[model samples]
Target: MIELLVNLIVSVMAAATPLLLAATGELIVEKVAVLNLGVEGMMLMGAIAGFAVAHETGQLWLALLAAIAAGMTLSFLFAVLTLTLQANQTATGLALTIFGRGFSALVGAGYVGIAAPTLPKIHLPVLSDLPFFGATLFSYDPLIYLALILLAATAYFLTRTHAGLILRAVGDQHDAAHVLGYRVIRIRYLAVLFGGAMAGLAGAYMSLSYTPLWAQDMIAGRGWVALALVTFAAWRPFWLLIGAWLFGGIMYLSLYVQGLGVPVPSAMLSALPYVGTVVVLVLISRDHRRIRLHRPAMLGRPFQATN
Candidate 1:
């Protein structure tokens, strides 16, 4: 039983990695009051690009880099449309998601059934070879640790840094930020690109680490879940980690239970994460004031500088 429990814990952490990374990125993006809904799209593009590059070049790092570039490229398009052209953020984000889905599918056609090299685990000397706890906690790919570091960095940046203060000020009141001579558009552009890069890294993890292969629509709505996670976390980085792990535990549990021959429907198991997302959103939405307090004041609104 203890071994089984250990295995479950490890699986849950692995499952949560991608969501955690994506949510961290979105937290930064929304911190600057720019809502980029192309996370799913960016992730898909990253998955395909990472898989293709890794498959052909046998270089995992290059594959990950390709994924980041793919994600940033899509995000740049989003920035241009919304920040420069003042397009509707919602419509453009949705369209970008659709475009990513189709584009990734077309790009991944030849790579179907191709198996790329899996990401290597960093086996520390004494820590990795210890008993159950060591294997459970220390045996994951590098990206897992990177996610935790990212969470810490994000929390510190938002709470303890001057630049973070500037970002929050810009998000809370872009016009006020503009009045203070801060470049609101440029800040938001950087935030969006960062968000996209994180999302892409998450996608690359799916292909090069999680499943280690590519398939059509392989991101499988993880992007949307990450988006919902931002609300579940109430826009805080620490809470985002909790929400992501909770959802990840639930997702992994569903699969574990199915494997136990509980006679549960596979469809129901698959729906667990989405159902959890709804429940979380509903619970958080019940307190309108709390939502108002943490939410960026200028989110989803376009900014323009007037001379």
Candidate 2:
């Protein structure tokens, strides 16, 4: 029983890590009042880039870096259009996603069906040998720990630092922030780029650690789930962790049940996580006050600096 429980926890954490990473990046972007709907596309690009690099070179670090670069490259385009040229954020972001999808598919065509090495798990000498705690807590790959560390750092940055306050200020009132010499466009650019890096890292995690192979649209709808996760978290980092795990468990539940010889249809089981996502969003939407209070005021709004 204990072994079974530990395995479940490990699986759920693996499932949750990518969602947590992607959502955390989106949360940062939204905090700066910039909404990039291209997260799905970014993740897809990262996945293919990471998979291709690892398959060719067999260097994990290079693959991860490649993933981040691919994501940032796409986001740089997003920044130029929306932040610099005053394009509509929503439309530009949608276009970015579409472009990422087609681009990744085209690039990944040659790499399909190829397998790559997975991330190495950490094995502490004595600690990792411990029966329950070792496997449950200390045995995960580095990215899992990095995700948690990043979340903690983000929470601290947003709530306990001067720069964080400035970021919130920009999101709340960009013009006012501009008047105060905060450089609203610059700060937002950094936020968007950081979001892209994180999304890329998340995509790498999916390909290198989760499945270790390339597949068309293997990200499925995880990018969308991460978006909904931000709202489910009410833009709070701590809640984002909770929500990621919840969704992760839901995602893994179908496989677990099927493995146990449950009679549920595979299609329905596959739909469980998305169904849970819709249900959670509907429930959360009913609470108008919470969302209004927590949502960034300048979110999805274009910023124009006046001299």
Candidate 3:
């Protein structure tokens, strides 16, 4: 029983890693009120970019950097369209998703069969030896642990810092922030890019560390799930972690059952996480008065300097 439980925990962590990373990034982005629907697109871009770079160079660090760069670069396009050009944020974001998917497919075609090197684990002395949890929680690939650190730091950064307060001000009310002499647009730009980079990095890690291979549409709607997670957490970082892990566990449990020869049908198992996504979405939408209904206030609303 314990062994089965251990394996289950490990699988859940692995499954949750990419979602956690992406959700953490989005949480930061939404905190500043710029909703970028291109997370899946950026993640797909990072997945291929990181995979191609790592395949050529065999460097994990370089792969991660390339992935983040790709994500941020794409995000800049989003910023230009939504922020500067005043394009419809929703339409533009969805367009980016279509563009990213098709673009990632084209780029990934050449490296269909190749596998990128994986990230290495850092095992702590004495701590990693603590029966099940030591390996399950403490002894993970460095990025897995890094995901936790990102979560904690983000939680602190949002709740503790002056900059955080200022960013919140901008998201919650842009005109007021501008009236206070704050660079509302500039702060938002930074927030969007930060969100993009983190979202991209999350995608990169999925490719390099988790999947370790390139494919078409491999992000598998994790981006939308991350968006939903923001509402589940009520814009709070700790709930973001919980929501991400819950979804991740659903994803991993489906596979683990198959691996363990559980009697459940494969089709049902595979569809579970997505099914859960719909259920959660319904629950989030059940409330209308709340501001963060999977979206921050002033999100998708243009913030013009004069208007």
lDDT scores of the candidates, listed in order: 0.92, 0.92, 0.84
lDDT of each residue in 3-34, candidate 2, tens digit only: 78888889899999999999999999999999
The residue-by-residue lDDT of candidate 3 on 1-307, one tens digit each, is 8777777777788888888888888777777777788889999998998999899999888988999999998889998998888888888889888999999999899989888788888889998889857876567887888889988998887779988888888888889999989998788889888888888888888888778788789898988888888777778888888888899888987777788888888999888989998898788667876544445677657888974
Error (Å) of candidate 2 at residue 25 is 0.3
- Candidates ranked by TM-score: 1, 2, 3
Model 2 misplaced regions, further than 4 Å: none
Higher-TM-score candidate of 1 and 3? 1
Q: Between 2 and 3, whose lDDT is larger? A: 2
What are the clashing pairs of model 1?
A: none
- How should the candidates be ordered by lDDT, best one leading? 2, 1, 3
Candidate 1, residue 186: the lDDT equals 95
Per-residue lDDT for 2-30 in model 1, tens only?
88877877899999999999999999999
Off by over 4 Å in 3: 131-137, 262-264, 289-295
Question: Judged by lDDT against the true structure, how good is candidate 3?
Answer: 0.84
User: What are the RMSDs of all candidates, in order?
Assistant: 1.0, 1.1, 1.9
